[model samples]
Target: MTANNELFILSASHTREKLKQLRRTHQFFCPQCKEELQLRIGEIVVPHFAHKKDSNCPQLFSDGESKEHLIGKQQLYCFFENKGLTVQLEPFIKNLSQRPDLLVTTKNEQYAIEFQCSNIPIEVVQARTKGYLNASIVPIWLLKTPNFKQQKPTRIQLVQISPFRQQFITRHPQHGSTLLTYNPTTAKFIYFSHLLFIHGYRFIAKVQQLPIAHQYFPFLHLKEPTKEEFTHYWRFHLHIRQRFLRQRFYLSRKGVQDLLLKGCYGARMRLDQLPLFIGLPVRNAQYIDVYIAEWQATLLFFLQDCQISILQVDDEVIAIFILNNPDYFQDERGKDAILHYILLLKKLGVRSIHSSTKEAIILQLLHSEFLAKCYEN
Candidate 1:
């Protein structure tokens, strides 16, 4: 049997009992293609409509809906509907020729909620987002929560946010960058907020789980990481950074060509001896594709070659560096990451016209407690 749960084009939604009674006499059609739809209410799956065997609709039924997707869609529909909000399930927008899983409308905004389950290309995501934006509809993409290891609610642990998952990271005004995901099995909304990247795809983040009953339309605003929580995060970050340094020495095959290694070689410094401030966390560091150490270390090397001391570096100089090395910095915000690293250095009082004198400041910053030095305003 087809797993597709393409809904019928109807003015109002109905209960299973009502739908079953109507299925006996009334006929339903696809909203977009105007094709006949079959109502499938089985013991195993949630009640939904599907296209016939021979029907080849261009939209709605193209991608087969998974059990999780169907259940989650229905759950979200009820979740919003019960809140007395205007919500449409599998509504086809005529102008854009796009059918979002759920189109939610509030007093100020209309949002197209895409409950994505399967892996799709980034181009498809961009295209859909562009279409929604052009039609003046905000697109909120939610992913099915992956099977992650259960951790204690109080503990801070390292979680893997793969490259694909990174695309869904959205920036909120009050909170920092966050990714929202839903789990159908438990009816929970798992939020990974204030994500601080430690290494490639590995991040030390603040996670919160709320039952569907407690979840709000505009997600509940999370507070900033407390000082105690940040202390734990820094300790975990140091652990991961040490591991990354070790991996580069023994596991990595790239010798001279590697950016970090090349910088260390040029500076005549060992991996362990490298400055502590080089890999420290920066806002928008996620925009750059490489690790924090790789870009920051290379920036130092570039500064040395150009005879431009770290004390003299400014936004224009960093922008020029980003332009010169396009391969390393893919996004425009990458320049911001580099500048923020410099800002951190300035915060730590790293000032010297002489390149040789930087070691003293570096050593001081390295020996100081991370929380005291970095967290201080």
Candidate 2:
């Protein structure tokens, strides 16, 4: 909450500068609870209203706002104001009992914009979003931009998407899936879209940054990647996939039965000899909470256990695997990842489905020139 800039009511809002000068002559009260508020002015911190030590406000409470949050909210409010949109800072809604950082109104719809700069539980985000949606108001959550040492926004980059960050991921009709972040110091907005989930906590995202002054209300969507760009992405994906497998083998304890390595040994296959289709990217694979290769290998091992081929794979097999290995999946829908992976396997195995031996299939399917080049280096 940007306490410095919240309104006396929905109609009357005060700036920090106004609050600073008015502190000597006037008193302020919370907009929601109507309790007397102490105007806190400081040299380092921004001028804002604070509840006295003993005061209690049921509608809202001070969470000790950070300077970054205060400034960011203020800037966003002004940015929306400059666009001639009806915007309110920290409007306390009666029905939802939620104080959105900025309540924006357009001709036909309302939106609750939360400029989240601090780490909060995902449950809080979910509840707030649910509240807004239940009230027929859309929720837009923008996080603080992370510090990227040498970020190249033009191309795909490996970014750490922590659990907290994952809560902000949203889908736009035009943008597909996107996460928006703002940098107050630079006055720029970073858009992360077309997320390609690599593994745990890491993603290959298409990143772009726009100056706040040039930004528009209905944010611009990142264009889909071209064939050349996708080729480069797959090359990078292959590189990271190999690197991840090597790290797993190297990092596993000597005495521990490593799932991936053990599966490979049991199948009489080397890491390099594994099918190219095993670790290929699948939609929603990230929700499985396991390495793409590891889980995909598990699917193959399961098929061997059932004495079946890819064509024989069905809902029963998938259900049984999911039931037995519940830890790999993060949610119920995570089972879809296995199904999607099987679909991809079936597509790849169209030519090799009738092959007699697993070794023969592996040898026969090494025909993708692109994949061959990717794995060779």
Candidate 3:
């Protein structure tokens, strides 16, 4: 048979019927034991065929098909009805761009029910639920299992939103709905609702709100730097410097090395190794700019063919170093150092920076104002 014909046979509902008829009519031989087998149905689990004796049965059959997905629109409608909630199945919701599984409206309150069975991307689900909330509709996520049964609806477990912060909060607590858990064994459902304070109103489902004092300058757990780690860090520092320099100037290996050595021992030392200068706060913008300017100039002196661009956004001066020669700093340290610099610059209100290669440009921009504006809206 062709491939399509085989698939059709495998998916046909009659496959299970045929197996049931065969079991009743014939005394089939045990595939493993080669002895006469007795047929048993609905013996161990839900509707299935099994052997009488626990012999070594090598062959396996599942009605020759995959189980049909049970958590469809109709199933969702029946589920809510079983909960004594009035539901309108397949309600049109424009924000979702698809019909909700069930639209429940009761006593001047309304909610959209979305039953999701498969493991989907978390961000996608968050975005969809956020959109629903923005449209003044509450979204109820009915997370079903692969084997969705009305008698044993799968319960929703409370997952930690921010494990690092030791915080647990439901996704959309303001919607006047709670996370409901369904017990398959006992056929019971439980609801959970709790309030949590989060810094930003971005549509994060499980947000762990750290202490407000550590909001901007979170204490980083530091360990003594190993030689290998220091080498990697220095290499990253060098790569970012070289990339920026190549954007403004052209330099030979000898020239680059000389410049790096000069900056390492000179002004770059004060800013790059901030922990050493304990009396002077590294958080100051002037202090940060001093280091940035020194590093930028060092790159310009070494790489003569590169261009460095700086943009002032808000209280921050963003720097972009474009490198013509890309292979100079292709290690992890170089990438990490550049990213660290961007984050530091952002914290200090020096806006953003872009480090560019021939292929792509890495951008580090702050979104505090943008986030604040989003909440205001």
Candidate 4:
């Protein structure tokens, strides 16, 4: 990661300043390794710092900060600085033994904003996140613009999504949770939230953007999905499911994927006949790869207009009957397969209520599509 120069350099006081004098007199040092640095204030390129010679410092050993990275970082500094907020560039914490790119303090909170221009290990991210947490500082990571890819008008898939990146997902008021990214060049914040998990490393989010200087949202506040918006997203997802049902070869054969394929085909089931309750959204659905169709089909044949013993119809029975593999689930592995839908069914007058009903459940497959139309109206 060899770059000829950098936008700013650190001094003994850890201050970043522009070139004012014709000839340099201040002794600037490398921020990463504490080695002495050389300054180049040329006309063609912006003023920057370079290593002495043939240095191999871990921090400096990156793909070298690009022009976008440098300008983006400086602009981020300006973002807080313009608001008359007290901000520091590369503030070093002795106790934590870490230096964040920018640190700011409000009336009651301290924030460490890291403008991550390059990819780094999730462990490093977690370690730094933990350090900031231990020091009572909130760490906000703003990914570069290139990382957020817009696949379609309504679909924005975040690039390089690992388990660690998934941790960065936070709740937006209307949307359940969102992955946020900032475009330093445009001076705008992009909100990629309201995700519908398709597969591993693949999700489509409702895309919305706002300028950084927005009066109401000085801080990030992505728009929450409205009733109309949520329905539109759900309907689009249904279309996707329709396409998948037509040709299921795109999916990898692993875990319960084959089970879903075999069970649906074996049942001679039509996707149109599937109940809305079958694919009820769950918060932790991302943890398991089982599609909504897989587990939902397990409950289809079991439902009748009769009161049944709840204990006998557990996750194991469902897994065995549908998947032909009872050993797949243990410790209530797929207990949630129908929990929410069952609860909603009762709520929606699809089941008769009984006082002190604990051991038995009365289930009847109400025409869910017709009910969905009624609900939609």
Q: Which candidate number maximizes TM-score?
A: 2
Instruction: Give one digit per residue, the lDDT tens place, for model 3 in 189-288.
Output: 3233221112122111211222222221111222222334323323443444445445433443554465444544443442233221111111111212
lDDT of 3 at 90: 51
Give per-residue CA lDDT, model 4, range 1-377, as digits (tens): 11323424322223334454522545656656776666655554444566767877545521246656666666677767777777777767878888787888777788998877667888899999999999999998877655434334553332345665665776544435667777777877777665655545655566777787772313655454555565555565556556655455445355345655444555565544454444544434444455555444445434331233333455555455445434434334345535544555555444321213221221112223212321110
TM-score list, all predictions: 0.78, 0.80, 0.27, 0.70
Query: Per-residue alpha-carbon lDDT of model 2 for 1-81, expressed as tens digits?
Result: 224544553112665566667766666677766777887767787665678776678765444888778778878888888
Which runs of model 4 end up more than 4 angstroms from their true locations? Answer: 1-27, 30-35, 40-47, 54-63, 147-164, 172-175, 215-218, 249-268, 271-273, 299-338, 348-377
Q: Model 3 TM-score?
A: 0.27
How many steric overlaps are in each model, in order? 0, 0, 21, 1
Candidate 1 stretches greater than 4 Å from native:
1-35, 56-58, 149-155, 250-269, 287-289, 301-308, 314-327, 330-333, 352-377
- Model 1 C-alpha lDDT per residue in residues 27-98, reported as the tens digit of each score: 777766677778886667667778888677888652367888988887888888888999998887889988
**Global lDDT of each model?**
0.75, 0.72, 0.36, 0.55
Candidate 1 worst ten-residue window by lDDT: 368-377
